[model samples]
Target: MDNVSSVIEFTLSGFDEILDYKLTFFCLTLLCYCVIIMVNVVVVVTIAMDRNLYEPMYIFICNLCINGLFGTAGFYPKFLLDLLSHHWGISYTGCLLQGLVIYTSVCSDICFLAVMAYDRLMAICRPLEHSSVMTRQRVAQLVCFSWLAPLGLLSASTIFTSRLKLCGSNIKKLYCANWMVAKLSCAATNWVTSTTPGNVIAYVIILFYIFLGVFIFCSYVQLTRCCFKSLANRGKFMKTCVPHLLALFNISIASLFDAMYMRYGSSDFPQSFQNLLALEIIIGPPLFNPLIYGLTLSQIRNQVLHKYLQNK
Candidate 1:
């Protein structure tokens, strides 16, 4: 195939062809990106600088914020330019790097969230041991591993992707994504087909062990028991857990569905649904993840508020 074919570059049929929302989309996306960066920066910096946020959970939050910031950093500039110029022209290396950043960040994001869940489980289930178990050393190790795993995956995948020869004009969807980039290849679709399964299986296994089998089940059981024991002060526990639970649920659903869509329904899906799904998967979680940590989290909120008040 390589001998027979010349390398092909993709021609993205711009979103303006069907929807003339380029300028509008550019403004909206820029605003959203700005908010995402600002909020996440404040949250991460506050956690790092604040004396009260020196604990394991806050450290996890810091990692989460950092992942999000980097993840958005990878996509927003290119996306913003595409939106403004309505030019979806991207080189092979640039597209590959975008995919690398996205996959790396996404893989790290999910892994870190799972780690955070485990941390929370320890805190709730074994409060006495939580301090020792979720130490700074351990949290740092987890963050390192989270980052390294994705980089490894991306490296392996990129090797295979780089070998594929492209033919004809590259056809792309509204966004720049790995699978979309891969589809433009004249070579076999095996990479695209295989990528989702490997990632989903890895995450699902982690989910099974950490979330389904242990954290979710055990934590809820203990949390329930605690709530029942504190009948008069039920609201206290609820207030603490509500935001984290919601955040996890949101991330899980969005991530899981994204994986599923990529694996099973890529070609069969409607363009509009595909567009919306991609947007939701990309932008929605980043927009909300910080809110889940910053606004709902008492320590983060308190620090932010205190800083704001002092500045005022």
Candidate 2:
């Protein structure tokens, strides 16, 4: 207990084997971070500035871009610093904060996707009623739920985590994660046996993802059925729903790689490969979401081109 009290930081081991290429990795990471910021900001600003593009679908897409920024911000700065200094450690408080930001951002990604799913379902299947059903008030409520629900869930997990007496001060990954931090507690076994607040919150978080996965699946299933029945509906699906589906697929694969690596990763794997697996979620979505949306959403793409042409 006393030793736990004295521990103030957790050492990250993800960068240990990359020291030989730190300079190259740092430049690549810095470039990647800047690109993520520029692309997502372009989509967000395009949507915000154009009143003609104001609609529920565009609004949700904008929120998704904002989330990509929020989630990546938790990681890239700290990672860049570690790459430069060769010091891969975070303060205990910093670890929890990072964990909170990263997890909530991921959760919010799924949440927004689910909301967008529902919006598409309404737009394509109930086109006549889409305007009334996805009203301003309703869109506002869904957007708030997408952010606030995850914030509340992750906050509870973080609060419960703060109560544990950590028995270890080393983390295996590049950034702190809630599950990794929870695994360090002296009461790791008790997290499963004694039903502590941390364990309860952890279970709820898992169940929430399960529910979201099912909700998204069902939304898309019905959407597919509706699209198949009519040619016009299929065109609508191609124009609008395809981008969301592509974004969902990309983020899902990246997130699954991350979750699988966290739970089942082994030292037998090369550190560089392991780092790639660990970083897939943060890297892929932040870069791809903006590109996916900007290219596929005709209104946004045209607006972006118009802005560029005007500048010229």
Candidate 3:
């Protein structure tokens, strides 16, 4: 039967597959996403209209809002629908598109964070060159590459992964992960394994290792320099750098753990743990980006309040 038969579509076990916690999980996730979206939207609005927030940092914040918005959009709709219906069904093309957008948003998120880190590094460590180094043209170029590089990577991923012949059961995690899709392949092991490098999981690790190494070294050096300054100047420097450090902490922990989990633990770990890890992909950055940036920037807080009053 194994050799003779073939497969078509995949099925997913909805979060409510066990029962009882359906409504609770639904309400909690919905509330969490609502907060994430609202806060990011406020940041975006403040950056757009507030004259005071027209700086490199806030511009990066705006870009982060857009990425988080689209990224959540890609996952939350299906997640919500699954909660409502207690069934998880996505079309083949739908799965592909979801994977594509989710990966793109993720890659874009990485690029933006790296850009933000470099921006902070220049401002803190190379203050004289801050303006000249991160000029409008340079910032525009960086942002463009952030958006474009993901497309290139994802295109390579989608093409190689799609060519493999999926056999029968398509039921993956609540979402369509590329590796899980590859698991359904009837093709030879080599063909399936060949697809790993093109997958999102692999590239995420490669990019993060490089980025994280550089980020940690740069941040530590900057923090060390700040420690030696006078209390007043040091406090000012710390104020600017603290949020970035916090953001780096959040990104580093969530990304490193999840990447490691997906790579090494997918098979060994329990299904529940794997699912939780996948949720981190959606929830971690959304929760941190606005909170960290808002806490750090006075201008952002003022603009947010100003906008709230004007809308009222």
Which window of 10 residues has the lowest lDDT sum in candidate 2?
Answer: 1-10
Better of 1 and 3 by lDDT: 3
TM-score of every candidate: 0.82, 0.96, 0.85
- For 85-137, candidate 3 gives per-residue lDDT tens digits of 74567777677678788877877777777787778777766778999999999
Which residue pairs in candidate 3 collide?
7-167, 7-168, 10-170, 10-171, 11-171
- Candidate 1 has a TM-score of 0.82
The residue-level lDDT of candidate 1 at 129 comes to 95
Model 2 misplaced stretches (Cα beyond 4 Å): 1-6
By lDDT, the best candidate is: 2
What is the C-alpha local distance difference test score of each model?
Answer: 0.68, 0.89, 0.72
lDDT of 1 by residue, 134-178 (tens): 877898898897788777766666655665555544543555555
Model 3 misplaced stretches (Cα beyond 4 Å): 1-8, 14-18, 191-216, 219-223, 226-233, 263-270, 309-312
Which portions of model 1 miss their true places by more than 4 Å?
1-8, 17-19, 187-240, 260-270
Cα lDDT tens digits, model 2, 1-312, are 442335589999877878899999999999999999999999999999999979999999999999999999999999999988957899999999999998898889999999999999989989899999999999999999999999999999888777677888888888998788778877677667643677778788889989988998998899899988999999999999899989999889998898778767655888778888889988988899899999988999999999999999
Error of 2 at 221 (Å): 1.4
Candidates sorted by lDDT, best first? 2, 3, 1
Residue 242, candidate 1: Cα error in Å is: 2.8
